[model samples]
Target: MYKLCHQQQVDNACGFYAGHHMLVIAGSKNIRKPEDIVLSTGPLDDWALAGLRESLAKFIMSEVISSKGEFHHPTATY
Candidate 1:
């Protein structure tokens, strides 16, 4: 069975990766916002970027909830 600790560890790793991705996008000239990164304006398309945004949003929200112990979506489905 997967323990909460294991889940947390995974979440932490995901949070780190998501943050890194955001940082890289911010540093890059073409990608300023998270939405921009998803938009890609090059080889990639908007649908894929939308998915990335959703995943990153989940990871970021999870990190914030774990660390701050406040602020939550009362009826968040995701």
Candidate 2:
């Protein structure tokens, strides 16, 4: 999705990437059934696409910060 978004020059590539990542994570975690995830995120015209993308980005970011050993740069020596 990142590559596609970049290649297509979609506005806010990070949003596209974050949204795609959320959909994948949701499918794996069973937050939503795989079929629903596939259908919702697969089509550009799907009514739920915008909502799913926006919410997933927020949800994923929240999870990232809340998870144990939260993300940090490996180069940070402090």
Clashes of each: 0, 0
Give me the displacement of residue 29 in model 1, in angstroms: 28
lDDT of 2 by residue, 1-78 (tens): 212222323555445555655666565766454444432233344444576667766765654544433564445454
User: Which pairs, if any, clash in model 2?
Assistant: none
Candidate 1, residue 17: lDDT: 45
Q: After superposition, which runs of candidate 2 have C-alpha atoms over 4 Å from their true positions?
A: 1-8, 30-43, 53-78
Full-model lDDT, candidate 2:
0.50
The worst-scoring run of ten residues by lDDT in candidate 1 lies at 1-10
Which numbered prediction scores highest in TM-score against the true structure?
A: 1
User: Tens digits of per-residue lDDT for model 1 on 1-78?
Assistant: 311111223432455444445655567776445444432223323464466668668766775444553555555554
CA RMSD per model (angstroms): 15.4, 8.0
